[model samples]
Target: MDFMDFKNKQTTVVVVGAGFAGAAIAFHLTRLGMERVFVLEREEFPGMHASGKNAAMIRQVVPNKLISDLARGGAAFLRNLPLDWPVETKFEQNGSFFLASKKDSEKIQQDGAYAKQCGTLTEWWPIERITEFIPIIEGSPASGGLWCPTDGVIDIHSLMQGYLKSAAMNGAELKFSNAVKNIVVHHGRVCAVQTESEEIPADIVINAAGAWATELGRLAGSLNVPLTPCSRHLFVTKPLDWIKSKWPIVWDITQEIYFRPESGGLLLCPCDEEVQDPNITKNDPLILNMLAEKISHFYPRLSDLPILRSWSGLRTLTPDRQFLVGWDPCVEGFFWLAGLGGHGVTVSYSVGLLAASLIVEGNKSQSTNQFSPSRFR
Candidate 1:
């Protein structure tokens, strides 16, 4: 079909999935004057999966340099969103404390150094200083901690909605409960996508399906990128007056556990990373036991607190655990914005921006080379 004919036939840039990555990509595309962008979400609402179910901590002290850069950019985007965007992206700038005992001090220091190199403000604080912020941690075995004042908690639901609303306002279309079944390629180029109900023609196909990204890529007849979905659980406590809402989110790097104030109580996670299917992962009761044990060994005061609620989500991870962005080397017009892991909420904006840039401007941009999907090839 001719370009005009294709345009008339609903030629669109279909973004599979409606989490932070997909929503933000759609938002940026519309902001850049792309009028026929379509977002496909399997859930009834955007971010109902990993995006909304995460801990929502924005930490720039990622393990990799590229992820650190993305976090920095994404954090800046979140901080400045209120100025230009109509939707309110609620973010609590309560900061993050990464604690480490004598065993993991060197690694903590190395992470702090990397964060510093990435222009993230980090301060090495003695374990005693941790008591000033969180008194319950005083008796913990932590020797020192890296204080990242810029790391904060965000309202995941609000942020996801804001991205969707902004994208919709700019003429991007969103179709929830519309799962992509197959990606139809014509002459080595993506031509259309088949959903459960209908086939939609598309000029470009973006795989932002989060944990289901690997499945989407397979539909396009591409190589299997090593993607795994890991289940992580978060638990909340009943309201406790002693737990101040102003307390910064604290992570015990040595133990792989983190806790922060949430709704007059405490939100805690054991930092468990169990590989699982992309479907709804059930909360592991053993995790609760593990969390309680950790709390008893560390913060003894909250060990007996009643658990209010808990939920689990999958963090999609690549073999290298870094984000996969840019276009596929073998499949023309097929793009990837998956992996992300726990960094999705922290780096969604930057990831989406880079993905959209790669689609509109190709690798001519300076930052595009680092995250290009071709890197895996």
Candidate 2:
């Protein structure tokens, strides 16, 4: 069928992925009184990719100022979820520690100042103070660390479900196993999308497809946005009695490695970033060994801990490492909300609100200009 045939059927806004971005956008749009909104997911359920596989830490101490602002806003929103929300997204106030060496201590301090300027709760802890919270890092780290007290861990599964549930309650439709195959655009504007079984007529198409965003953009014949998928691995050790259940998430900032207490054991990541296609599968043995060796160097006591399991997920990144949020300058009804990288969960709420604001109201905010897709053009 043609655009006009489908256009007369329904005036719907079809979101192409049901992860944090898609679900959150659907929720916000529905709340704003948009009735014909649909969230499409390729998997049988939501958050099957990065959203479900993230480290689940709500960290506010990021390198970029806009990211820090988004993280701050998202963290606050998670802390104060509505009372009637269906799912209970458990927010563990375990805190986060960004350990830095003497060389990078000054930079961390500068970033901490910026974070404070953004109204986030952050403190600089010396080597002595670091041991109070993270006993394992007594003599390992070179200098001090930045302690973000408001930073915490979140149950990502529940958080995604909460967004989807809230969106469904507000009259949004969710279609699972509907992988969008092609986009039907006419007059340089999005009109509909073709899935496996049906043709979905949409007034606007939001590209929240995570790792597959660029491919979707190509399907729509829009601007070719650069999105790279980097694989990050996570390893969890068998439950150990030595580690406390309340241990804060610890990361050696100079070395891109982090570990957090998980069910009496530890969940660790070597922070390995490899450019790869989006596919969910097993963990790489080399990455596991690398993580173990790195843990041995920094955390000798827990290095030999038996690994209970391991898995890998892709973190979609842009060239500057900032999110590409806005509409495609060349395409009329196509919006860009991809390139979240590792901060998807942390900045999801704010990103969704920003996307909805731009789609529904237009770019009227001062901050919105920085994230426009036209920058690449």
Candidate 3:
């Protein structure tokens, strides 16, 4: 296949990974009138990894201001999805509470203020208010919490499919179960992508491979942008009368534990992060013990509850915890939309917008400087 064939008609773009990042980028690229977009997913379907396995929470008041800005923008988009959004999704606006002990209370307050300045509605809730909203934290060690009223949970699967569906409706081609084995680069520029069955000629290749991003970059001979896939577990409890569906998500930042109402019960995470291989994640039996310890020390009221089920997912992180969403300086026409860490679901929309702008306008997109792949080099 001649690269000129597709390149002459349309900018042939191949986006690896059909998770939130890839789906959103494809959605926007097509929305912006780009025609030859191909989304290749190794799995039989999209969001088979972290995108589907998350708690589906839309957290906005993160410690990183840059990520917070994207979170705010993404949350706004989720709250008010465009009139033509392809699928129906329910965004549970029960809000979120980022609790902290006295030592970290000031930081939480400051972060909340920054989110507020960025247009997210945030309030500093006292300990009394926190417990009033969720009685389980009554005797907890939390001094106070940052309450972001707009933060909530959404149906992640529906959201992921919505992006793909919209992109497909606009002309992006989605090829599932096609794992890219190698990227064909010539003259320091991406020319084609070799998958399991065939070689696809392309003008641009996007590395949105989530946990496998670093591996994909290596295939393309792009910058070795240190990305690590870390695994974490989420547990769900049996239905309890005390669990309130309207209760906001409560995350103890200092303790690194968070829980929210789910399916007449609660979804909990001990915030365990362990470096792991790209797609191989297993629940360590010891993490459950760790969670038990944290629960006993923190919220005794919710201790020893019957855990119904649990699952693990990967969150790829950069050393600085900021996202990598720009072009590869070492390899031309190879862009990056990876390293979203744990905030992918919360910030995917705005991240896609930024990535599409950079890909289309190149250096003219001044905002790409902060997240440029060259920064790592």
Candidate 4:
């Protein structure tokens, strides 16, 4: 197969997911004037898997420096959507509190310092201040907490739709309910992809299949990127009188538990990570016991609340927990945009922008080069 010019507007590019990654990438590619972009989603609707699931929090001051940068950029995009943005979405800038025990206080504070150095405003609030801010957790076990003023929750569904809709408006064809059955690679180069209904020729193929990314890569005979899809459960409580909707997200980094106001009550997670098959998430009752134990030890004040509902979602991860983005070294014109872990909602925009830049310009800067998929090979 002859390699077509990436700059050619006639080049057909197929993205293999309609989740955050694929939607954002298609949006950016179309925005860059790419005319023949096609997005194939297995589900009838977008964000049916990991993109629609999980907590919709925007946590910027994470331990990973590279991911924190992307989170910051993504948060900025959500905070101020473009004037031509096709949809309206809400971003609750209620901020967040990352609680750490005495043993982990130094590391959490150091992470806060690093975030500050990276231009994300952060504050180390003493135990007294934190208790006063949230009276319910007055006797919390955390010695102090890292306060990130910009982190908050977002309307993930709307945000995802905006990206996809904007892309479709710019000549990108989004084909839902179309699963790629075969990625025809002839002589180490991808020529076309056969879907459930028809086959489409492609000059480029992007693997943004979320949890099924590894399976999709196998179909393309691409690199064996160490991607794992881990399932985690989230529980929401029934309405409580004391719960305030404006309260910020509180996370116990040491205990690995987090909670925020939801539906006149609170949403909680135990930060459980269990390896599971792609797109098949089942809630484990044992994890609820673990959540109860963690709540009893870390947040005893609200542990007695009644559980209203629970659901599990997949978070695809690499070995190192950083994002996987770049062209495949094994197959020509095949890109990797998976392995976002659980920060897809917070870092989708920047991740997509970075992937688009690498695909378009084929240049890697010092910062951008860290996420290259070739490193794993």
Residue-by-residue lDDT tens digits, candidate 3, 204-236? 999999999999999999999999899999999
Q: Model 1, stretches more than 4 Å misplaced?
A: 1-11, 363-368
- Enumerate clash totals for all models, in the order shown: 0, 0, 0, 0
- Candidate 1: worst 10 consecutive residues by lDDT? 1-10
Local accuracy of candidate 1 as per-residue lDDT tens digits, 1-377: 11112223234799999999999899888877788999998888888889989898998887677888889999998888855576676888888888999988888788889888767889899999788768878678889898989889998888888888889988898999999988999888899999899998988899999989888899998757889999999999999988888888899988788999998998999888898887655878998998888888887866788899999999988877878887777787788988889999988888888877766764455244676666667
Candidate 3 residue spans exceeding 4 A from truth: 1-9, 366-368
Candidate 2 has what TM-score?
0.95
lDDT of 4 at 259: 94
- Would you list the rank order by TM-score, best first? 4, 3, 2, 1
User: Among all windows of ten consecutive residues in candidate 4, which has the lowest summed lDDT?
Assistant: 359-368
lDDT of each: 0.84, 0.85, 0.90, 0.90
The number of clashing residue pairs in model 1 is: 0
Query: TM-score for each prediction?
Result: 0.93, 0.95, 0.96, 0.97
